[model samples]
Target: MTILIIAQLTIQETQRRRILWLGLLMAISFLAVFGIGLHYIVAELDAIDMDRENMEIATGLLLSAGLYVVNFLIIMMTVLTSVTAISGEIDSHTIDTILTKPVRRWEVVLGKWLGFVGLLIVYVALLSGGLMLVFYLRTGFTISNVLAGSSMMILQGLAVLS
Candidate 1:
């Protein structure tokens, strides 16, 4: 219960600070730009009558490259959020308010971790899912093992979130 309360409060704090909004906005814009580029590139390739094997290779490279960028963004976002979690509250004396509650310090930490994990999961789903969706809808193709692939990205983020 204590952990849940702290998690709820941290999520609220994130909203109040507008970090969540900014991240969502950035994700949306990134998706839009990437989708446009991908569509036009695929159309150009089709217009040139690119062979199947070469076209597949080109699209595969493009998708992987985009995913690499997404992974980098995830890692950077994780670092940014972690840097601000406890330390930011301490610097601003907001930790005092949380500590004054009948909450153990460990509970506070765990709660923050819970909140962050939830937030990052949502982020990964939106960005990665949208990327994959665009790739498929634009090209009539699907990546293999999407579940395992996305799980790996979450684990990558968890490494830094820890």
Candidate 2:
């Protein structure tokens, strides 16, 4: 019961932050631009006459670079979000109100962590879906392995946070 209440409040508080919305919008815009750029770059590369092995190697490198960019962006966003979450409340003295409640401190910590985890999960899912769509449209192939690998990276992030 306490965990639920804390989780709900944490989520509500996170939702109330204007920075969160801004970050989300910025991420979406970034993804779109990156996708278009990648599509054009790949198309240009494909136009060059190279041996099958060379072409495959070049394509793999290009896709790997794209995946690296996506990974970096997602990690940066997650770190920004998580680092700010509780510190923001404390800075504003908003945590005092919660501290005065019957809840334990550990509950507050855990709940906030869980709330941030939920937020990160949603962000990652949307970004991954966007990347998959872009890759499919541009190359006629879906990088399931890249998606899975990114998912592991996200989970590793969550583990580190906990």
Candidate 3:
């Protein structure tokens, strides 16, 4: 119960700071740039009457590249947003109040961990899902194992978060 409350507070604090909103804006910008680049590439390919096999290969390669970028962005955002989670509190002396409370030391750590994990999961989902959607719409194809691939990205973020 104490952990849950702390986790909830952490989430609210993050939301109040508009970090999530900023992340979304970053995601949208990435999608727009990706879409425009893809549009031009497709237009050029169509103009040259590229063969279906070559188009498929190109599309697959492009999808892989885009997904890689999405994963990288997710990790970067996660780390940047949560880097100061605990240290900043201590630095500001805000942690003194919380530590004086009845909350256990482990509870504080766990709560902060859970809160950031939840935030990162949502972040990864939105950015990765958006990337997949845009890729499908632009190329008229779907990549296999999206969730599996995204899980790897989530794990990557978690590894850094720890």
Model 3, residue 48: distance off in Å is 1.8
Where's the lowest-lDDT run of ten residues in candidate 2? 138-147
Superposition-based RMSD of candidate 2 using all C-alpha atoms, in angstroms: 2.5
Candidate 1: clashing pairs of residues: none
Error of 3 at 139 (Å): 1.0
Tens-digit lDDT track of model 1 for 1-162: 989888888777777776577777777888888899999999999999999889888999999988887887778767776669899889999999979978899999999998888777888898899999989999877789887878888999998999
lDDT of 3 by residue, 31-65 (tens): 89998888889888889999988987997888788
Model 3: residues >4 Å from true position, as ranges?
A: none
How good is model 3 by TM-score? 0.93
Off by over 4 Å in 2: 49-56
- For all predictions, the C-alpha RMSD in Å is 1.4, 2.5, 1.4
lDDT (Cα, tens digit) per residue for candidate 2, span 9-40: 76787778776787788778877887788777
lDDT of each: 0.85, 0.74, 0.87
In model 2, what are the clashing residue pairs, if there are any?
none
Q: How big is the positional error of residue 111 in model 2, measured in Å on the Cα after superposition?
A: 0.4
What are the TM-scores, per candidate, against the unseen true structure?
A: 0.92, 0.81, 0.93
Q: What shift in Å separates residue 110 of candidate 3 from its native position after superposition?
A: 0.7
